[model samples]
Target: MAIELKPTEALKLWHDVNLDLVRDGETDLTTRQMTILLTIYLDPPPHTVRGLAKKLAVTKPVITRALDTMGKAGLVTRRRDEADRRNVIIQRTVQGSLYLDRLSDLIIARAHALRP
Candidate 1:
């Protein structure tokens, strides 16, 4: 069933999840890194550095730096596009999917503990 949350409840849940993540010692992602990660996972495919920069209203270098960090974390990968050797395509990984799934579960558990 879907649970409707007021703004305060939503904010509290967000805070609780962040705290839990910190306690778990998961790699702390910056706001920009999180944005880029979510954009790659949640958005449609054929994701390119240029496309992501345009989508996030940031520069190519900004995306590249974030990707470098996330790549080391095994959250995302980049490869030259076969169709266009000059273009780099961003790809998702099993580790990245599992990481997001765990975070979702953490948020859900925190939300369930909230009083109506």
Candidate 2:
């Protein structure tokens, strides 16, 4: 499971996955957007605008903007916390999960296809 790659190999793998993403005509996520999505999915529950901003070391507006784009894409949804009306909690959706699943498959396939 732990595979090491040389710098060139790593770049090749990255390039291949990116090419596939472009070819598939899927949502083109910015680096920041992808980082936010990955953090939300890979991290624990109760994700909030404040929390993500702090964790990612970005401003709340920055998080909000990325969420806005991802929200429209159905990659994420937000709801005001009933307990604390000020907090916006981020929630995952079926579409978001499927998108990541496909992305994961693409990365794995591209990694396997890398020249040794």
Best prediction by TM-score: 2
What lDDT does model 1 reach?
0.91
lDDT of 2 by residue, 21-113 (tens): 888886789888999998889999899998999998999999999999999999999999999998889999999999999999989888888
What TM value does model 2 have?
0.92
TM-score of 1: 0.89
Question: How do the residues 9-68 of candidate 1 rate in per-residue lDDT, one tens digit apiece?
Answer: 989988998898789886689989988998888999989999999999999999999999
The estimated TM-scores of all candidates read 0.89, 0.92
Candidate 1 residue runs with Cα over 4 Å from true position = 1-4
Estimate every model's Cα lDDT from 0 to 1.
0.91, 0.91
Q: Candidate 1 has which clashing residue pairs, if any?
A: none
lDDT of 1 at 25: 86
